[model samples]
Target: MHHTASSHSGPDHGTPRTVAAHRQAFHDLLAAFARPENTEQLPLLAALGRGLAMDILAPLDLPPFANSQMDGYAVRSADIPDAGAELRITDPIPAGAAPAALETGLAAPIMTGAMIPPGADAVVPIELAEPDVFPVPGKAATVRLPPVLAGTFVRDAGSDVRAGELALAAGTCLGPGQLGLLAALGITVVTVYRKARVLLVTTGDEVVEPGSPLAAGKIYDANGTLLEAAMRQAGLDVLRTGISTDSPDELLLLLRRHSPAVDLIVTTGGVSKGAYEVVRQATAAQEVEFLHVAMQPGGPQGLGRFDGTPFIGFPGNPVSCLISFEMFLRPVLGTLLGSPAPRPAVKARLASPLTSPEGKHQVRRGTLLPDGTVRLEGGAGSHLIHALANSNALVHVPVGTSALVAGEEVEVWTL
Candidate 1:
């Protein structure tokens, strides 16, 4: 057995497709299904990790007015032309309260963030003055300070951002600093793109839910949980449909019922040419096309529209299902959702000799060492879930290379 599904007879289907060709086809399919998510206005505090749907312009200058950056005496720089000059103190200015314009030869006590009084071109910190503290009200008070340059310790109007300037551009991903900037600009609400909603399904007669009594010849379903977690990490809103049995009618019913409510549908297993391939049989008359890509572990792949929603099917193996998602779905989703792409591949020496088929790209689970060497975690079998769990990276052995010796460099994709 080839361990993969044969290409369906259709105009869109091609026999023995290359990995690159399948990836391109998948990208085109995603583009056709890329309906723009509706935007909604959410409170600024509630918009973290969301993608901005529109540009945000500053409504007013940040700070809006000149303010003091330090708790000190506001004075004219010329008044203290020499260090240690004493100036009579006036009323203290608290934050959020206005102060009278400073008279010549006099100083006004000002706290940090207080609006700068008119005609005061400099601030001498309280520690620089003789009293070293705010002066008492209604008492004969004076402050001695060092000579300073004009505009010292002043946060001028629009210093951070000017009014009507671009505060955040459209498609910007909101994080802590971005939210802080919006708050500082006094923006209470923002428009953001809605997250993509996905309907995930896994299919197999031998697959059973975890925590159930173990029956002979039945394996617990791990693909559903694995792909669900992956989808969530990719910023998708996922609805898992548990496991569908080997009944084509049951699977089709589930798909039709949930297809209208989701942006995309993802299914694992049943795409291969095995006798119990329900997904393939269920979508036989639909537009879905099943093909075998030129890659090991995840060669059986399917993509099409079912009930007007985009659908992708993977092989039954847990490792194959994940590899398919990483190779095809992740990059396209990241592009549409404004998230980072998969971790980049790095070159590492092979710690052991390995052999691959002449034409298929082999993806082997492996452990990447700190010394830039990669050791295979499991053999090239699809059912080794324990080996997959023990590995932290995927070592990519490209096509047309049948064998490799130890210490040869290969590209490893970090998990």
Candidate 2:
């Protein structure tokens, strides 16, 4: 059925279809058109949020030796009988000092990070020891330690990490913890996958840039800015963001001009069958297929190729545009571009009865319940950006589920 472009409204505007069908449609589109190719070198400090292309291996064992985990005495388990065995403190070892072999009937004073001498078994913190000052070896120095402590203060070699171990798997996004681990291993350089370059465009005469006077009914260009920011946050590198009037020639000109330089070209608005829909008319000749996807809020989707570049056209409504990105582009491209997969929805019970068309994927904005339940934030409307803003998850109510009564279990995706 052919539907003309209309004003964005609640989730009930389009013909209904299944969630699986919509997801498959997106996957097929990506298979046919998404071909990201770009690479760059970044310092380890700047590598956070970047994707790693190669696996990271530890060249040396973590800790590298058996060392004291605490400040206390290092003693051989054999020499120290049950409780109340006192051995003279023979040597005081501070942190980072090399290990010294233990002689029978002798104890070593070890600090945190110091290697345990040979023949030591465990670590006892200073607080657990009998309180007394110990004489320094070969010098007039003394250190205080609580006496009556048991166990040797030693950390086994390779206890934390073994040498030549795969520390980080390939394709892992280098987050702070991963970066810190690499830094601790003394790695200065790392190979990482490339980032996707996207071309973004905002269309419509009713849209104005920020700081511009708004004629009545005209609004600031929220979709463009919103899409760009969302893409960046997803670890995508936007190549160009252009604003096109409701003219087919201008839109095609801009797309064709920038197609060669970007991995994907994304446009917001004007893909619908509306009189002012320039993107639809222009891209139809470029082998782009327009589909009324089986989903709410973002039903009118256009996917095709311009020359050899992939282009995706989203609905103009602010919320609709963002939803399209999250539901469709962000998931697939994020993975292929080496970004982390979008977190799977947390389990949530339905807080209220939610109705849906017999055959459409309903992405609902809702509050997450403390006990893992989801309450609809407002009416399931695409223009309800306020509700979307407050929501941390999009409850995916599958197609054919005409209605879900309150307290029903549902899968939700964290926003």
Candidate 3:
């Protein structure tokens, strides 16, 4: 059931649903809008930050063959009976070249990463030789080398990953290391889950584009740029449209027009009880459920669908809009996409005393100090967008507790 819009914005208003309840509903709404399981073959570079769709098996042994770990002389350990034993140097092997077998009691100068000769059992560094330099490839030479045990300075085949081994598991979030591994395994193309595409709608008659000159009561449209950056940073493909007017019909037309192409439609503002609540008025007849989540900085929220595309609405105030995305939308999106890794959460001491409204989860913007304390940036007002800009952390004051003393420990999510 949907909540009716009420003018009261304070804690004395109707009982609002808890943040946990809103998050659960939001997850269900996304599942309802889920499309068919799809995968796309992307090049290694393009696959970064995407979830791998299938397990990748190592086609060949990592390193492929035994190779020298340093510039050294490849020798049979038995030949080096002592440091004074001099063995005739046969040939030099450089990287990217096949090495011929080493005759018994002979040494081959092998460069780092060069494959070990077939009959060579160990590598003694050039410094360990009487003449500490490699002989000319065609020269006949003898060098006194220190003794080394078999397998010294050797990278054995399959040391890292054997052929047919599970190199990368399914659903692994591909990053630089993962992509590099795929490239090392000779994989140029990879299958990854497609990123969700979201159409963001910003509303309000007083909101003007940034490039436009501001007049009497108009403010620049920050929710568009702010939420767009947040969503794109979270790995969603963002499609932006012109800011919608306060007219419900105009907003509804925009949503319906864009819903066919995007996986989700997110709107900023017009979901509250304000007289010009375009998002609420437009989707009221449809399946949208406007809500009052038990949270400060963000309370008015709406979620449902517009022509089968998932819909979410946040408050018009810049801080509240962004906090709603962080507290409600971001976590769920990460779980759904396996990307845009979650922010680091840690326990931080409060720098000062503060009281929160009982029964509401308060999200306060703050700067996480190097001393492990969180200093509040500004008061708990939703319009303090500047505070958000200055914050490096989101301090969460959970429901049920009312006040916190200086030095009190609290949970903080580092931005």
Candidate 4:
């Protein structure tokens, strides 16, 4: 139970907690305040874009042998039969060297990843032979290939992945084609999954920090540069601190000085119910809770823990702290960072009419339309940060419906 909220007796909160039960109580308070993240290893050029904490296998055979995907001659396809048949070149492999065996009516000039020489089987393209280049080595050449077929350009040996297979599976994400297939399988390092540091904060005494100066009723701190650019675009690491004011002992001494380095505290404008909330009076005595989830711009929120880390909070509107980090911490940090691409939700249509409130869950912002139609861009108002900077899609609506009408469809999400 570590604090739960959303009960407001029987009227306001009793029936408001729905946005899918407060996003499944922030996925069971981040699976009981998460804490597994430690993997590392890295190196494949510092594991570009991270995430894969295991399963990579294939440490060899990804084209680890039968090479030469063309640079001319290799032969043995019944020693070039039809068209012109000249075959006699010999010695010229040049790609990492190691070719010697093609004697029977020789033709080996290779080059283009080289290696396939022991009595070759097929390559033919140095622009289809007939003296198309590489032939000098100690003179006496003869190239004229035309009958190509036995594995035509050749590149086999586990043609991409098979030194025991499963080249990349443990939550893969690396990217540039999985780090160019782990650098063509030589692999150099790679374990990954650590990232999520996150401290962020951002409370408010009327905010104001963006280039300072403002005073009458403050307001500039767009939720600390909008939740530190949405927690560094969801890859986490953040830290921030910045605004904090409505003091609850300076927000519990800034959450006990960044709760020993951070693994998720988030906060953003004291958890609502106004009158200088200060993260609901600095974790009112630890466990947290706050609530009000029916969702709209972002319905108040606030999860648990703080000294034990894992907090959450989020509400002083910058589009309700980026629609509550796109409805509860971007799908639980894309499933605790195993994120191999998650986004999803699409559907479109609604170009105009909207409303929403009978039970909660509204979202809004929109824009999608390139014929797909979504529209909205600012009105349900949660201090409209320029309508979430001219929208890019969120829409949703759900909970016992209240209005919708302009052509209808809906769903959206995609920001």
Candidate 5:
């Protein structure tokens, strides 16, 4: 393939890349920055989305002691074989109360979760025993026991969680189920990895806020809203979000102002080779390196330090901005943020034919049918916002694909 840019040294051989090459390179760069911070203790209820700092070990044995698994008569396993007979009631045991010692020839009334008293070897459920035969008034829960193993109805201590057992491991993202377990263990708080701070900004002279009046050639600021929403939904604590025109001084000033407070700074638009690309001109003198990737829509990618803060610059086009986040930022941040990254392309049959550039990979928005078929939502233009709105997934056609046919299986990345 013909080279598109000047030579530069990289982890890969010094050669021009198809869009896939640049995307992978960008992903590697983000991955290299994936060093998560040490975990912090959060209230048990609020730890749902954080990664566990270390293995969760049970401080005490679950149940702590043997107890009845059901409402039954605690008796000796050496009792008679049949259970439809009455046994003398010696004592009553309720949950959260200590049990009385079993007498040699008498049974004890027991409820579910009631501790089994000493000298009792088995439990006969109320249903398995005969009704009260004792003529005692207002106090009759005695029952006959059916022959069973010594520990048949007993819930042994630590059955749910053994003392010192590892319940959760480090790097584990806490969920509702995990929180329930920790709560059951009586843990009031837990340690989880800290969240990354992010700053999102959008640029362009033609871009305006959503509720503002649009000029003749201006467009609504879709990137800022879309990206900022996506980042917050992904568990990032966004420090600041703003919009600026194509002014190098303004963009530089904003970056410098917010740099110290954020872990990542993401900007959309103004990174390409165009003359008015303010972000490129302003950040070039700093540590950020701008490169034209081989991918469609999101071809221009930038990485560098914005006032000593890590920055990711994406293409100005709406779709390109979103795709760059999914392909690069989302995956890395998901890992550090302790959230699941969006799923990648699943194989789906093509519903129609399409042509793609020979040297660059194409990511097209499409609607995936239940029958495992995929149809391009709109034409291959990057400006097709309505098409993107209707699409449920993005089809990833690799670099070498020049033409595709109906019924061909392709990779589809769900949005």
Candidate 6:
């Protein structure tokens, strides 16, 4: 491929890039950042979306003891070889209670999850045994049970997981199922990879926080909340600034104050080409480089390190900020840290015709229908945050293809 920009030191500089290339470049920057490896111990619930730092070993055998898998009679499999066999009923064994060894020609009432008595090897469901309802322990003379082979309906010790075995491997993301397994293993605490602490900043003099009286020139600050919510949803810990600044000096000072405490810095707005670009002008001599990527909605982007901390600048429009993070930074975090699981790319039928620019790869917001068709939500405006909020899926129009007719199959990423 022909190089698009002036020669630079690394793979990415102030150059134009396709969607895929730009994402890759950003990913490389983050990978090369000198952030130290860190881990934290959290309670099982709090670690649900965190990556495991160490392999979790089963502290002891799951089930701890051989337990009955059914609510029925526990008997020695050797003693009952025929369907109509009758055995004397002894004391009943409820769950969590230990019982004495089974005597020959005797059956003990056993509940589900009840520890199996010594020498008892099988359990018959209560419904299958003769006189389906269980009789009072030792009150009935005899209870007839069908022939059951050894180990039938029996949960053997360590059947789920053995002691000292790996329950979850390092780098595993603790989802509900994984957490449930840990809970079953009686693990209350877990070592998880610490989430990258991000210092989020919003720029522009025209932006003000919501609830403030709207002057002639100000709009409520949305980029801050939009990006912060998105990052938190992806399992990244967000540290936010309550103030939005348009002054380069103020922005730089804010970065300096928070840089030491954060693993990364992300600013929305002021990266695009403009006379008064706050983030761009502030870091003009720093390591960050602003580029116009070949992607609609988020064409302008920035990436570099600030005082050794990884820094990323995204376009200011709310839609651009959200989409940029989703398409670029979010996926990179998944690859690097293994938290915030990756979004699945699937094919969906388009419900309407759409046009894209010739050289730019475009992402359009849409809602996926139950019938598997994606209906476009709004036109390709980078400032349309409401349309984005209504969308549940993203339709990709790659660089080569400009126009797609209805019913054509296209790649989609579900939110």
The model with the greatest TM-score is: 6
Report lDDT per candidate.
0.84, 0.73, 0.86, 0.77, 0.75, 0.85
lDDT of 3: 0.86
Q: lDDT by residue for model 1 over 173-278, one digit each (tens)?
A: 7878999999988778888777778999999889999999879999999999989998887767899987899999999999999999998899999987677789
Model 5, span 4-36: residue lDDT tens: 122212412334455545555555554533444
Cand. 4 Cα-lDDT: 0.77
Q: Positional deviation of 168 in candidate 1, in angstroms?
A: 1.5
Best by lDDT: 3
Give the alpha carbon lDDT tens digit for every residue of 24-47 in model 6. Answer: 877777774213357788999999
Ten contiguous residues with the weakest lDDT in model 3: 3-12
Q: Report how far residue 257 has shifted in candidate 5, in Å.
A: 2.2
Better of 3 and 5 by TM-score: 3
Candidate 3's residue-wise lDDT over 125-160, tens digit each?
A: 888788998877787889999889999999999898
User: Model 1's lDDT to the true fold?
Assistant: 0.84
Worst 10 residues of 4 by lDDT: 4-13
Model 4 per-residue lDDT tens digits across residues 1-415:
3563433222235545777667777777766323445777878877676678777788688788898886877888886667658777877888988877887888877788878988788888887667677867889878777787888889988887779879888766677888888888777888777777878878777877888799888768877777787777666678786777787898798789878887778877777776778787777777777767777877777777777676888877788888888777777656655643566688988988888986777888878978998889868889878878888878888888999889989889777
Could you estimate the TM-score for every candidate? 0.76, 0.85, 0.86, 0.37, 0.76, 0.87
- The backbone clash count of each candidate, in order, is 0, 15, 0, 3, 4, 1
Candidate 2 achieves a global lDDT of 0.73
Candidate 3 vs candidate 4, lDDT winner: 3
**Model 6: colliding residue pairs:** 269-316
lDDT of candidate 1 at residue 212, scale 0 to 100: 95
**TM-score, model 2 to reference:** 0.85
Ranking by TM-score: 6, 3, 2, 5, 1, 4
